[model samples]
Target: MGFEDLEPIFGEPKVEWDQGQDSVKLRPFLFHVSASDPSHLRIHVTDFHSNTWEAVKSVVQLEDMRDNIGIGGSWSEFVDYVIASIKSEDLKLVMEGHSSSGGAAYAKLVGQKLKGMPLISIPLTKLLDAAASEAMANLSLELFKAFKNMQHSLVEEQEQTFQLTKVISAEKERNETIQSQLDYYSKRQKFQKKNATDKADVSSTPMSNGLQNSPDKLKAQEASSTKVVNRVVPAYRRAKVRGAFLQDAEDAKDS
Candidate 1:
């Protein structure tokens, strides 16, 4: 229903009328309720500048009202059900002073519904303490998670660095081995070249010093000298034989 329907239970609500515009505005009011004894259960309905109405509209839209209130139940019954659902020992309502909106009489009538029910006021410091404790707890949890993540990242980085170092070291050892083999080959090539150069120098040095001889030239010079000697000796022998024959012939003629 409407606020006008609640006027029977909660006194008359303040109203403002504009005859010129033919419009009416209902002044906001507060409704307070509490149970008897010291159970600390209470409920406060404040509609200052229609703030309460706006909050309710945000939660329960017009289209979803049927689902929340049901087809047979009235708005008043839905409100009653919400109130009955709260356990007297489970909930505590915190009240604060509001600026006067000329609804003190309506609040007084609504407060009379539950006689001997006293308003249990909670201190502002206690609320602040509870809020600070919860905030600190949440901050600590976030910091713990951040530290854990940082530690995990550091471990991952360390592992990656270790693996990289291993690869680098292996590469270095391989490079060293390759370099050593290259050095060995280079030394062997240099030694072989030096030996070949030394042999060439030794062979050329004998030729440069005129110590190399040919055996065919020496044998040809010896045979030419022997042939000249044999021809001279045979000619001298023939000349001597002829001289002896002339002597013999001259002796025979003188006889």
Candidate 2:
């Protein structure tokens, strides 16, 4: 409850302790006692004052007290609990510290002391190790998440690329098919046109020749008929006269 209560158990502190005012330097530790609501007992395992970061000129401040030996409001209860924890003359206080619950730093204050020794030690190495482990864990988690995201994105990109390639290939195939069709159509059209031209030429050749030959045949027929008419009519009349003359000539001959 007060400094008086602590004096009996811990003896006169290495440094004089004031109630609710400041800390008491107890050898290698600094003891903080709070009398207000949410009363706490903070024991430093390191010399925080000596390790204070330099602020302005002559203004130094302790960045991290990091001194946690024993905590909680009931000192008597913890004292009794620690006493009861002694099994077979072995003063073992194996407390598993939790720094993650309530989203706050380590809640349990941890410190050490040897048997029959007035000195309490706050191992800075252990706390720093814990802090480092926490930091590393968080960093590892962040890195893992980042890598996972990258991997996911890479996979997605690959899938998209594959899909795009497939689409391109399909389009290419389609274009090729269309091009082939066009070529086929072009060749067919050319062949059709050539065939049509050839057919037209063949048909026109017969038509032209027949037209030329028809006029020649018609003129030949007219000439032959006219010549025959002229020769044959004269010959017919001569035949009649020549028959009479022949008859006269025959009679003359006979005479």
Candidate 3:
């Protein structure tokens, strides 16, 4: 009729620890506190089950259940109470249940959003199967399957790594080729610039020398032209004088 009667068939509830209020606790472990005065509250401790003991334990932990209980048959209200209780932030739910409590405890750890820990369930049924299976039984084939899968994964990872290595090596070779080409181009540019400058200097030197020589050549040509003009002017003056004298003699003879 009661848990005591059922204890023989089902294992007794496991005992959990309480670190007190204001400390962080995980899920499934409920603590109740009651207050002697309206301003104060008392503490009750138990699991989160609907058992009679849990009901009594809740009251002992809290002054009243009015603030913690849900409206009749209201799933939403019950969930709200549970969520509000956790939000108190001052209360902690210790994880301490075993077997039947395992599911509840694991849920609390996960539901309360505990960090750095995950729930692990090792069912007794599975444990028995694993223990009783023959060494060569097909029942344990899952191990072989997992091993083969792991091997495949390793092969894939190795292939990916090799591909990455080849890609990196190719990139390095390309960079080297580009660098060599750049260097070659830079050297060629410098050489071409020097060659062009040298050609310009050689061409300019001859043109400048020719330009300088042109003034002297012009002076020599001008001097030769002046000498010829002077000689021609003297000869023309002598011819004029001879013609005038001949005219004067003819006039005298006519007179």
Candidate 4:
């Protein structure tokens, strides 16, 4: 089958016309399938950079698949198997170079060349699937941690509120107790003042009542007191009178 036959399986390919090399390149053609590393699939078709052969021969290089293409299976079956194998395994990639000392030397010389090239070639569908899964996993973990932190913060806030409520309640009760004591003392003070006023009124009542009931008797006593204070006694009278009893006795003796 031609490279065009692979279009239905691998989708449209990007074509590169190399004018200098006079060879047309089509990608992403199946290049290699790793026996050990299933995810390490490579998609590149390499041939001599010449245009002498037919286009089919140049583009579809069967020699490249001699190792991986099974003896009895078709190309479609082999491609399907490679895709299935990659999906079933975890996503990873591996790279290899030509087994030559010059290859190592050349790699060292060109250390940063093609630095960002992907080591493995997977279908776009598989790559997107893997990326989506990893993103979801990371997002889920972050959400879980955030939820736990929110729960902890909520609990702490509630505890603080409870404590504040208790303090407020205690203060309110204490204020009420102080107000009760002040009210009681205020009432007692008012009662004591009223009692002292009543006693004064009672002590002055009897004298006021007696004056009102018997004003004449009080005036008489006042008059008597004034007479005694103003009264004067006369001095004794001088009197020399002979006793009649002495004369009687003398007459009797002469007889």
Candidate 1: C-alpha lDDT: 0.42
160-254: candidate 1 lDDT, tens digit per residue: 99999999999999999999999999999999999999999888766634432566666776898989878655565665554554557779899
Cα TM-score per model: 0.35, 0.35, 0.33, 0.34
Q: Roughly what TM-score does model 2 have, to 2 decimal places?
A: 0.35
Better of 1 and 2 by lDDT: 1
Q: Relative to the true structure, how large is the alpha-carbon lDDT of every model?
A: 0.42, 0.40, 0.41, 0.41
Question: Which regions of candidate 3 are displaced past 4 Å?
Answer: 1-131, 134-140, 206-255
Candidate 1 stretches with Cα past 4 Å from truth are 1-127, 205-255
After TM-score superposition, the amount by which residue 233's alpha carbon in candidate 1 deviates from its true location, in angstroms, is 11
Cα lDDT tens digits for candidate 3, 1-255: 011211101112233343333243333433322223433322233333321121112223332233443234343344344334433433333333333423222212112213332221111121112322331132125335656788999999999999999999999999999999999999999999999999988877766568658988779878999898887545655645445545577788999
The TM-score, computed over Cα atoms with residue i paired to residue i, of candidate 3 is 0.33
Cα lDDT tens digits for candidate 2, 219-240: 9879999998887455555545
Better of 2 and 3 by TM-score: 2
On the 0 to 100 scale, the lDDT of residue 150 in model 2 is 82
Local error of candidate 4 at residue 180 (angstroms) = 0.8
Candidate 3 residue 126 Cα shift, in angstroms, is 8.6
